[model samples]
Target: MDPLERLSSPAPEFLDRLAASTRALHWLVALPVLLLLLTGLTNFWPELKALHVGGARVFAWLHVLIGLGFAVALVPSVIAILMRRAARRDARELLAFGLDDYLWLQHRVLRAAGLRSVGPRVGKFNAGQKLNAVLSAAATAALMGTGVVLGVNYWSKDVFDVDLVGAVFRWHTVLSVLLLPLIAGHLYMALLNPGTRESLRGVTTGRVRRSWAERHHGAWADRVREERRAGEG
Candidate 1:
């Protein structure tokens, strides 16, 4: 029997546990991103120049701290991903897709521009989410790489050249700018879309309504049911 099937017919305790774990991790990821953005802005804008020197220094320290935190968070995230991968071996839900997911993506775009009537049905993850995850991961790596170079240069110039450090800083800035729009889009989707907003409740509460799971993860729900029945019989 599959664990997901058991989840579909979740005991109250199981649901509670799932909700709490999911919510904790989601907020853990979100808070730092928000802080990093606020601090980064104060560090960058000229109109906010008065805050730049002090703000940038503070932000730089904070960013590095948050980056280290992210690295720590990745340990658990990676473990979860591995466990999920083992469970879903071939299904690969995170990378899964079908006609519905594509249509949903199209519907979202049209709706965003006030051109669509109905949204598309999505499975465990829509195409947009997959894209966002990939982009965010790449951007994070780039930011961390550039940060390391800059930090090394700042603390010990003899380890690397001034020119190289400058170049890395430029790369970090460019990647950060590229990440801004995607982050904004992610926030808007999470906050503005009714379905997404409800889904996001799981981030804070740790457990989403059963209906939300049925609607957004129908296939997963189906699998969970199958697994449970198999386990019972």
Candidate 2:
């Protein structure tokens, strides 16, 4: 008999991970967020800005529009987490970080630096991933807050003082610059990094190879197995 095979039923090769609604919300927020990044960055880039010379106002307005949409899009996800049990569980899983996650991160760093260290088992998310998620969310919230002030001031200078606008402007630029690397690393891990790139399938297709999950996210994979067996029982 196969190792994964049990008396109840044979093992599953692909396990359901992300739900369809989760994927839908991801795409909904992702599009406007990506556009905001593009428009926001282009406004700061001298060469890029020169191409659109007099059209700076247009891009700036576009950025503000997208920012508003992104803020609105996030509200539903937050509401779901508050109102739905499944979303709450997923939020907990995504945000959880403890000793195992820390140990896994330490070993990963040491291995990357060519030092020997035994890898530790981690749940659905490791420390680095949870950190990334937390930072990204923080960045999103910060940008939204600062962007709103800037947007309001732009439309009506009487709304906020020059000193306040100047302060938020500096902070907005700094946060935007800092967020780029985090976003790059996230994309690399999802699309380029050999080790965890397969996880992209879980987000996109709602399923991942059981073997890959067992190796990379053993704790979560075991929980999934147990849940499935319980349901069968």
Candidate 3:
């Protein structure tokens, strides 16, 4: 088949990417995080501040609930990672960046800017995904900690002073701002980028087109094939 036809054709087979547990955990946090991001708009955008005070307060509390639920949603994954060896290995592999990951990213940046560049081999995850995962974990921890403090302050009388609450609020707001781009870029790659849109099935359904996997994750895809053959033989 021609290169264009091959690229455009439906894949002949699919490969498993995420486990059932992982996909469930993903949505558990994703839904609430989306709610938090939507409600969080009131906290930053200047025009939204002028909305009805009562409505704004409602959103503010709703944000708190969502944030708390987000943290709660992570509990099972955390425990499973700690207790299950395979989960730990998967987490480490997904998050850690090696030399090739750096080189791959360098080439990607150069190519994106229309410069000549040679790319390195890609594994199961790319540098961007690894960085996103790291940033996401850090953002989760930061938001959760600051959120708990702020939430506590909201319900109690004089438990946390104004200055302390203000400081925590600033950190929370700043972290939220930083997380926005990561979310946007992630969505764009999954939903809009033709090269990657096919992989969305891997996240949602735990399987992706074999052709898509081989092209984007050659190293890992080859290894999986090798392991499968070895097991069968």
Q: Point to the candidate with the largest TM-score.
A: 3
lDDT by residue for model 3 (135-166), tens? 97788679889988988786774798899899
Please write out the lDDT profile of model 1 over residues 1-233, one tens digit for every residue. 24564577675322221334444444565677677667667666655535445435555566667766665676677457445533344225545666777777888788889884586555556678777866876897777677667666655679987788888888988988998998998888778876577556555565565555666766655665677789899
| Candidate 2, RMSD to the unseen true structure | 4.7
Error of 2 at 150 (Å): 1.0
What TM-score fits each model?
0.68, 0.87, 0.88
In angstroms, how far off is 188's CA in candidate 2? 0.8
Q: After superposition, how far is residue 60 of candidate 3 from its true place, in Å?
A: 1.3
Where does candidate 1 have its weakest 10-residue lDDT segment? Answer: 12-21
| Model 2: CA > 4 A from native | 1-12, 50-56
lDDT of each: 0.65, 0.79, 0.79
- The residue pairs that clash in candidate 2, if any, are none
Instruction: Compute the lDDT of residue 165 as modeled in candidate 3.
Output: 92
TM-score of 3: 0.88
Pick by lDDT: which candidate is best? Answer: 3
lDDT of 2 by residue, 1-233 (tens): 23443343456589887776666655665677778889898776776655644644667778887787677767876676446555566667778777888888889899999999997776777788789878888887898889888878777899888998999999998998888899889889889887788778987998987877888888889999999999999
TM-score of model number 2: 0.87
